[model samples]
Target: MAIHKLDIGEFDEIDYSLIAIHTSLEDYRLAYFINQKLHVNLNKSKKEIQITVKEGEAHFSRFHYYEMKKDVSWDLIQNKNEVIQQQNENNQSLFSNVNIEVATKVYMLPEFKKVDYFLKIENSENDLNIVKLQNTLNTIDNIATIYLVDTNKIKSKNNLIF
Candidate 1:
């Protein structure tokens, strides 16, 4: 597995936050569902097949999809049933705070090879709360995994488990 670290200096003046979604499904399906469920219009990329929610986007690749699928399955098998149940309950509550009307954007980096889906929120005057956005995504049914990583906190971590 490869790990990538973020350079804090590059994002010092940026007031945006990133959310990553790891899944084994097609990006278009996921993007469309999210748009319908969240009531947002995610723009499509003409260069490559990608969907962006505002500036936040989702990409599809066979390699990453299979890798993430395997990892998610392994995680589920290793966890206890009760623990999973409790987490689901907590997620339900966590998603309650999400503001559906918040302006959100998605971007997918071509260098990542469609494996990583980055969600960018313009946090102008705290218009979009990172915590709430994270919670909302955590409850989504199809997403295999979701992460909220701050620019300052980026480091060599096992974010992508294949």
Candidate 2:
């Protein structure tokens, strides 16, 4: 008899720095601003990040940029999305069934509900200067606040994997 076991922690390594951004600009505009300030071309990903919750499926917009020279990857993702849930109402009148669409707020990281977006930087070779990056992001006029999130304290770290 043989036993096989897989340790999930062995494969789970937090190699990325997560930056929480509070901004009023749209995703595209923010991407543009980041490109201008960071000197990286961030393009919209064709496939959006999708999560299934009790309300419905939530789709989050993602912008990505890969610096081949530095071997660093950057991902800018929307933290909150409005998910429309359809509810069927039963009435005694002729219109017995009515479909009502209700919009619910879905957060990629529920713990960071106040953050509008997250900039995730994966520095494979430890070449990226995260402090400098944060300082540059702070210079953006549209950003109200910019701060680094402690990955160790995050409860929904799995949500960030994608």
Candidate 3:
């Protein structure tokens, strides 16, 4: 058989749409509202999106729903996760070996640190009706804002592979 090689750039051409969500509501509650308003059943995924950071391993919650008819996949992912890091104290007079656990916020898309959640749409036949979706999402009383994200501008694109 002749040697066959796949170009690495081919994988980089993966197409998907990302929407940034800003809200104070909890992850489950937001999923509930999206399910109700969008008429899609989004449920918590058993496997979470985990990322290893300087602090530690951070796990982000994800809700998934597949619209078979439309051939589209919907994922509602939490943008932020808290990782606890323990640091040993080096005080001479008092406790020298005390481990201080500090919580640090990790962002899935550090470029958009202010965004609370992300709605990822994949495998759509055509470009999604993003403007209409944003309008519908805005109607939800709890949602503060929703907008399309430019995937090309994201520095930490690898974090979104999950």
Model 1, 4-112: lDDT tens digits are 9998987456454556667664556656655555445554444333343333444333111112322211011010001111112233674764544333323233323
Candidate 3 residue lDDT tens string, 73-137: 99999998999998888888577778999999998888899999999999864757888889999
Worst 10 residues of 3 by lDDT: 123-132
Tens digit per residue, CA lDDT, model 2, 33-142: 99999999999999799988888898999999988888888999999999988889897987779898899999999999999999998875467677888899999988
Segments of candidate 2 deviating more than 4 angstroms: 1-8, 93-96
Every candidate's lDDT? 0.43, 0.91, 0.91
Rate residue 59 of model 1 by lDDT: 38
**Regions of candidate 3 where Cα sits further than 4 Å from its true position:** 1-7
lDDT for predicted candidate 3 compared with the true structure:
0.91
- Report the lDDT of model 1 for residue 45: 43
Clashes of each: 7, 0, 0
Global Cα RMSD, each model: 19.2, 3.1, 1.9
Predicted structure 2: lDDT: 0.91
User: Which residue pairs show collisions in model 2?
Assistant: none
The estimated TM-scores of all candidates read: 0.43, 0.90, 0.91
